[model samples]
Target: MMDIEKLQLHPAYRVVSDDLRQRIVRGEIQPGEPLPTESDLASRFGVHRSTIREGLRQLEQDGLVRRQGKKLLVAVPRNSDLASAAERALRMHQVTFGDVWQVASALEPLCAELAAQRITEAELAALALNIEQTAAHVAHGRSVVASTIEFQSLVAEATRNQALQLARAPVSLLMRAGYAAIAPALPQSGERLLEAHRHVFEALRQHDVEAAVGWTRKHLLDYRRGCEFAGLDLDLPIPLAMPADGPPK
Candidate 1:
C-alpha cells in the first residue's frame, strides 16, 4: 500500500558515483588503495569512460578520492577539508555567532577534559611552544587571532578523539574570522587569551581534569565578553566576506 507512482531517474554519473561511494565508506575500498582505471570502472558500471570521469569528479570534490600520478586512490579527508565544507554550509544557512559559541562552549570544555587525561608529552611541548610564540606576537602588537585558533586546534588534537576533533574544526575556523574583527579593537584581549592558554596548558600537563574544564570554559566566556565589548551582534551570521557596507556589528 505504497503511494509511490513514477520515480525520477538519477543521472548515470551520479548513480555510478553513489555505488562507488558506498564501497569506499563501507571499506570494500580502503584509503591509499587505487581505484580501478576509468576504462575498468566504465566496464564495471556499464557506462562510458566520460561518464566514469564525471562520476570520479564527484568523489574528488567530496575529498573521498585523490589522484597520485595518474591513479585515483581512496583518501581520508583532513579535518580542515571537512571544516571548509561544513563552514560553507553553515554560513549559507546563516548560522549566527551565538550558534557557534554555544557549540564551542560545550565541545571545547569536553575536549579539554579528554585532553587532560590523554594528552601526550609531545603535544604539551607543542602547546608550550605555541604559548611562547603567542606571547611574542602579543608583545609586538602583532595579531594573535591566528595563534588563538591554533591554540584551540592543538587542545582539540591532544584529546586523541577523532569525533571531537571533527566536531570542533568548523568552530575553530569560524573563531579565526570573528577574532580578527574584534582583536584589533580590544588591546588587552591578546594578553588575557595568552594567560588562559597557559592555564589550560598547565592543567592538561598536570592531568587536572577539573582545572582544564574550568579554564577552557572561562576562556570561551572571555571570548563572548570580548565580542560584546567590540560591539558584535552574536545573532548575526559570520559573513562570507566583509559586507558591502561594513562588517556586521
Candidate 2:
C-alpha cells in the first residue's frame, strides 16, 4: 500500500506541477511534446497566469521543460545543463552556496559508502569512464567541476536506491552552482581532484566502504577549504548574478 501522506508535491505550485509531472512521467504527455502555452495552462488550471509561470519555472529547473528561444517545450528528462539552471534559480531566491555545501556534506559521503558496498561492475566502469573524460577536460584546460559532478552522480546511481535518487534530485541544482563558484579557487585542481576521485573509485572497486566514505569526506572538506581560501563567504546568502565567464584558473 502506498503512503498517501508521503506523496510529493511542489509547495508553491502544488497540483499544477504535480498533475503535469504525473502526465509526463506516466507517458501521457510523451517526450519532445510541446507544452501548452501559459494562457492555455492558466485557463486549464483556473489559476492566474502567474501561477502557471511559477509551475513552469519549477519544471524548467527540474529538467522537465526546455525553452527554445521564447517557446517552452516539454524537455527531455535529466538535462545536462538543468543543474546549472536550477542553481541559478535558487540563487535568485537568495539561497547561498553555503546552504548547498551543508547538504552535500550530509548526503554525499553516505552515498559513497553505499556505492562501495553495492556498486556493480558496470557502474564501477561507468565511474571510471567519467574520470577518464574528466582527465581529458583537465588536459584541455577546462575546469573539471562539471565532470566531477558527473562522476559523483555515477556514484549515486551505483547505489541503486530510488529514494536516494529522489532525495538527490533537488540538491543537485545547488551542487552544480557551487561547483561553478569553487572551480576557479583551486590551482591545477585537476590533478588533485582526479587523484581524490581515483582514491574513492578504487575504494569502491575493492568494496572498501570505510575508505570510500573517508575519501569522500576528505574531498568535500578539501573543497570547502578551497572556497574559504578564496574569500567566498559561505555563511552569507549567495547572489544570483555570479559572473559566468571569469579568468581561467
Candidate 3:
C-alpha cells in the first residue's frame, strides 16, 4: 500500500510565484504597472512576507518583474533578453552548425528583402559606416569576424521588424561563432565578407529588394564555403562561447 502523505509538496513561494506568473502572462497585470505591495500580496496569498519576497524574486529572475525604486513592476522582457535565453538553450542542447545555418539562410534573405523596403536614411548611414570599418579591419590584417557580425546585425536592424529581429538573433549569434572559427583558417574569408556586406549595403541603399535578397543569399552560401575550407564539420555541434553582457549590437 502506498502512503498518501509520502509525496513532497511544492514550496509555498513557488505556488505564489506560479499564480502571479499566470496573472502576468494573462495580462491581468500589465507591463510597467506596479505590482501589489508585499504586504498586500502576503495577505492575499495567506503566506508570510518572506514567502512573497521569495516569489517576487523568482519573477524578477525570470524577467517578468523588475524593481523600480521601492516598488516592483511587471516588466516586458526585451527582445535581446529573449534572444539571450534562446542562445543559452541552444548551447545547452548542443545545437549543430547545420541547424543554425539552415534557419539563418531562410531568415537572413527575408530580413535583407524587407530592409531594402523599410530601411531609413539613418540605418543606411550606419550600414555604410559598418562596411567602412569592416574594410579597414580586413585591410589591416585584423580579424574582421566581429565587424562582420555587426554588419549583419545592422542589416537586421534596418528591417525595423521586432519579430524578425528576435527570430534571427540566435541564428546570428551562432553564425558569428562559425565565422570566428573559419576566418583564421581561410585568410581571404575576411575580404570576401567585406565585399558581400558592401554589395548588400548598396542593394539596400538603392531599395532593390531582389538584389538585396540575392546578395544576402550569396553571402550565406559563402559562410558554408568558408566552413568547408576550414575543414569544419557542419554536422558537429557548434561550440558556443559565453556571450557578453548584452546582445549583439
Best by TM-score: 1
Error of 3 at 8 (Å): 9.2
Report the Cα RMSD per candidate: 3.0, 8.3, 4.0
Residue 234, candidate 3: C-alpha displacement in angstroms = 0.9
Give the alpha carbon lDDT tens digit for every residue of 1-249 in model 2: 865676564555767888898888888887778888899989988999889899888788778888987778786766346455655667678776688788888789889988998999899889989889988987888888668877888898888886775466456645555566556766666777888999999999999999999999998887787777766678766655545633213
Error of 3 at 56 (Å): 2.7
Q: How many clashing pairs does model 2 include?
A: 0
Candidate 2 lDDT score relative to the true structure: 0.77
Ordering by TM-score = 1, 3, 2
Which residues of candidate 3, in runs, are more than 4 Å off? 1-13, 48-51, 240-249
Q: By lDDT, who's the top model here?
A: 1
Cα deviation at 206, candidate 1, in Å, is 1.6
Error of 1 at 4 (Å): 9.2
- Least accurate stretch of 10 residues (summed lDDT) in model 2? 240-249
| TM-score (C-alpha, index-matched) for candidate 1 | 0.89
| TM-scores for all predictions | 0.89, 0.67, 0.85
Colliding pairs, model 3: none
TM-score, structure 3 vs. true:
0.85
For model 3, residues 62-130, the per-residue Cα lDDT tens digits are: 799999999999998876677878887897799987899999999999999999999999999988888
